[model samples]
Target: MSFLKKIQQPKFLPNFLKVAIPFFVLVTIFSLAINSWSDIFAGDFAKVAEANFNNGKWKAFFGYKIVFSAIYGLYITNKNMK
Candidate 1:
């Protein structure tokens, strides 16, 4: 068999992940939506975490979570490519 034919038959994991990863993400979001959608859509500006970190300073944990989650999502996508 030729090299190209060999590569085409027993495929690599990246090829599987190319489809599986995105589908996993969509399912995760759907699950989260179904679980805490009430709290999400209700616009609950509640203190979900402790803010006080140091001298006269407050950390916006909720905002931090949102930003971190976005970064993590991107990281997961890039990880699969490699």
Candidate 2:
């Protein structure tokens, strides 16, 4: 398909990764820091997992990260193409 061909261009993957990887890492770290702040302060790191599991925060965090990263990557890639 034409869309596939466009994305197959040599620069496409590098351009997407250039924006996506760092963004994902930074955002993920920031999110983890925020979410674990209380546990960190209390020095009870084990509770972090229990809280996240009970509240389903982990699912939301992972979902948002994956979705946003892909969207941002595609947006940047398309912008670079133009």
Candidate 3:
């Protein structure tokens, strides 16, 4: 059917959303579960985050996502090329 064919087409936003939305949900759940918002308001989490930022943990944290996106993009590009 046309609907099935349409659904089968490779769409980046849907694929990324499948991963990203769930990731965001999980992070939110984890944050709430750990009650880390209290630490945020108390200034403890900010201090830790600041220390991590100064020490380059922010790079490590965000860099992995960048690397992953690059790799995934490459994979998609190669697949499309083929």
Candidate 4:
């Protein structure tokens, strides 16, 4: 079989990647919407985000992502097992 054909099969993807990818994408979209709303009604909080990254404060967000992803993964696992 060709590499492309093999990769097209869902069996190759681990369960966690499948669940985490969609969850991450959804969280990203929601975050962007919140940022846009914050920008329109208040001021540009994008600058604050950038400054946080510059100051290494964004590390906390990465931690949040990992924790949330784990929670989502557990929820999915529990649902699938039932």
Candidate 5:
């Protein structure tokens, strides 16, 4: 199929972070979510995430995501937007 031709394109390769970075971020988030859900085995995931965030046991809950998204946005945002 013609679609396969896109794979052979020589543009982003070699320096492939242009494609790999976003994918790695998404997969890492997904894995963290799955592990966070592991507390469901004890039937108490809700309590854990709440304790971590609400009690400030571990800071940067939303902060990490916010900062990462911002940095990723800065790097990934279309330059044409500026």
Candidate 6:
């Protein structure tokens, strides 16, 4: 498809990776900090893991991170190409 071919161009991958990797890492760390802030302050590390596992928050976090990173990467790549 034209869309696939366009994305497969030599410049696309590097540009996408340049923005996406750091964005993904920063987002992951920021989300963890925010999510664990209360637990950290209260000195309850066990509760953080318990809540994440029991509420299936890990799955939701992974899904959000992937979706957001992909969307942001594509947006930046498109902008740069244009």
Please, what are the lDDT tens digits per residue for candidate 3 over residues 1-82?
A: 3434443657744655555555545654464435455666677866656644557766765565556655555445344431
Clashes of each: 0, 0, 0, 0, 0, 0
Clashing residue pairs in candidate 1 (N, C-alpha, C atoms within 3 angstroms): none
Off by over 4 Å in 6: 1-5, 41-44, 53-55
Q: RMSD to native for every prediction?
A: 10.5, 3.1, 8.1, 8.0, 10.9, 2.9
Tens digits of per-residue lDDT, candidate 5, 1-82, equal 2323433555424234454466557755664566566665587867757755567744556556556655554444332122
Worst 10 residues of 5 by lDDT: 73-82
Better of 1 and 3 by lDDT: 3
**Could you say which candidate leads in TM-score?**
6
Q: Give the Cα-based TM-score of candidate 6 against the true structure.
A: 0.73
**lDDT, residue 48, candidate 3:** 50
Tens digits of per-residue lDDT, candidate 4, 1-82, equal: 5444544556534665678777877875576566465554567776646744446766875567667986786556444532
How well does candidate 2 score on lDDT at residue 27? 87
Candidate 4 deviant stretches above 4 angstroms: 1-13, 36-52
Candidate 2 global lDDT: 0.80
For residue 15, model 6's alpha carbon misses the true position, in angstroms, by 1.6
- Ten contiguous residues with the weakest lDDT in model 1: 45-54
Indicate the TM-score of model 4: 0.55
The Cα error of candidate 3 at residue 12, in Å, is: 4.1
The residue pairs that clash in candidate 5, if any, are none
lDDT of each: 0.46, 0.80, 0.54, 0.61, 0.52, 0.82
lDDT of 6 by residue, 37-57 (tens): 899789897987776645777
Ranking by TM-score: 6, 2, 4, 5, 1, 3
Q: Candidate 2 — which pairs collide?
A: none
- Model 6, residue 31: displacement in angstroms? 1.2
Worst 10 residues of 2 by lDDT: 48-57
